[model samples]
Target: MYVAVKGGEKAIDAAHAWLAERRRGAKEVPELSIAQIREQMTLAVNRVMAEGSLFDPDLAALAIKQARGDLIEAVFLIRAYRTTLPRFGYTLLVETAKMDCIRRISATFKDAPGGQVLGPTFDYTHRLLDFKLAAEGSLPDAPKAEPHIGPVPHITEFLNKEDLIQQEPANDKEPRDLTREPLDLPADRALRLQSLTRGDEGFVLGMAYSTQRGYGRNHAFVGELRIGTCAVEMEIPELGFAIEIGEVELTECETVNQFTGSKTEPPQFTRGYGLVFGQTERKAISMALVDRALRWKELGEENVGAPAQDEEFVLYHADNIQATGFLEHIKLPHYVDFQSELELVRKMRAEAMGTMQEAAE
Candidate 1:
């Protein structure tokens, strides 16, 4: 039996049709290709991949198109798709030291080991509007030398050799997966870093900015920032040896921050680490700063009630989906809620007026 269309159902159907028409735009205008988005909108795809924890460029591109260029929605779509896939054995720890680097630079040192490869950055370019680009113009490629191959040593290793920086102890413990398990309070460093990696970029950026603006100000120097491809390998149960699964582009950031020694400890520079899915230096750097701020308690420093230093605050508010869902839910019908509120206000006013009349009497 066919039922009559309700107000909401009819409205939803019309809205969907309108949205589809809007997504297409004018008939004369050429449609945006998935290839174009995959190539040109690389950053958006990267964010989706990073946040979704799925590294398929084609799928990300498709999601971006379906979402009408909303990267967060694309990320959510990818994440939903990812949840359906069967889990296999975990991969081996990537050897980042052997990364095929495209870009690597350090703010601390004049010249780094592999030398600074500017590689595909907008760092030196001026923010100018070019009318020619509006008509589909392109610029010539910048000059760059072939980067030094093999394992390029980290700059902090030099400082560590001289006891100038705090030593990061090697941990043999397996990291906890946030996706598989529920997030608990006072999370360990590994769990915290995982949350930050997939957290909303804007939220993390704001938290980091708050720290720099004196909310939890810890003087941070970029120890090193690198963008590169690293091989991901998985040990096959059938095979005796591990086989290379694939390569992924990654952005890694390490921040060296000022450390004040406790009564029993000696002074040494401390560090914060950030690793993300692609060419996202700003997010990576911000994550490191926020990570450092959150570690104040472990370092024996006073928790000055800063927003970044509060683990509960950062972890709870960082997920865009959680934030967006709650935000958008305000649009839902609230007739009952409003009616109750109106009744309460009217009753209060009546009581106040009665009291005033009694006083006058």
Candidate 2:
């Protein structure tokens, strides 16, 4: 009796060992600590948290280290870990107005009620790399300041007073969670925004840039951009009062886009909003513009046939995890399919040769 060869167990173990060794690199070099990764490679951690929908910076850092600095893989790890977490209770809607904002700015007005605070941005920095960063260094501590600033108000409140922009309606209706439900056709604003927030940064940015290059261009202006930590509160059924569960850093962007008066409605400026789970201003701003562009239909605007306007096109290709997984899976074995195709081609060639011989005869 003949027996089939079996090496699956050994193969898997060897592959895992090899992967671990490679991830660790040369034994001579020191391993990267989670804290180091979190502090030094903050942007990568931010991306992972944003996409993974997990706000734990330390866990994100650990995922990055395990992934060997592959941001996408790190994101995947975080996402896998995030799925295992138990859901306690839903948080009460965070009030941004009460947010002790560290940074806030508005492009609509030169000077607004809440004065623009350009806090912690790389915008003004030169593109040139600082060579000093190549070596570990520390800077001297600066002087401390008093902490008694009054609560800052939103600049949009001023515009709302003038009736220039549409006032947002507050609804007590519960919004559907996209993560728990399969994405459906004709998604609402909340679902679309949720998808965009967790989407790949580059993909969203490219879509936004395309809009600027005359594809669904809505003439967006950065109406406001704010980054700060906000308290997440949850109401206890027994207590009958909301309590602060935790705090999460977020970046919120609101874009003011051109709006034309329809036959039924008066002309007024419209807005697109983006809120991300970390300090990701670029992604948030890009998302807001794309969100506005996608709203053309609801606003009674003509279909521009732009990439951003195509809901299916934008939503389907936005997630890097889904895209990369499908792309890389092509590398896996498909010997049976290839063998079938090979046999078909050989049979066709043989048939052609036979026909040619008969014709010659």
**Top model by lDDT, which number?**
1
lDDT of 1 by residue, 238-346 (tens): 8889999899999999898988787645788888888999898889999999999998877888889999999999998988877877998888776667777888898
Query: Which residue pairs in model 1 clash with each other?
Result: none
Predicted model with the maximum TM-score: 1
For residues 154-242, what per-residue lDDT tens digits would candidate 2 score against the true structure? 66677788898877777676877876776786988888998999899999999999998999958988888888777899999999999
Name the TM-score of candidate 2.
0.92
Worst 10 residues of 2 by lDDT: 143-152
lDDT of 1: 0.87
**Superposition-based RMSD of candidate 2 using all C-alpha atoms, in angstroms:** 3.0
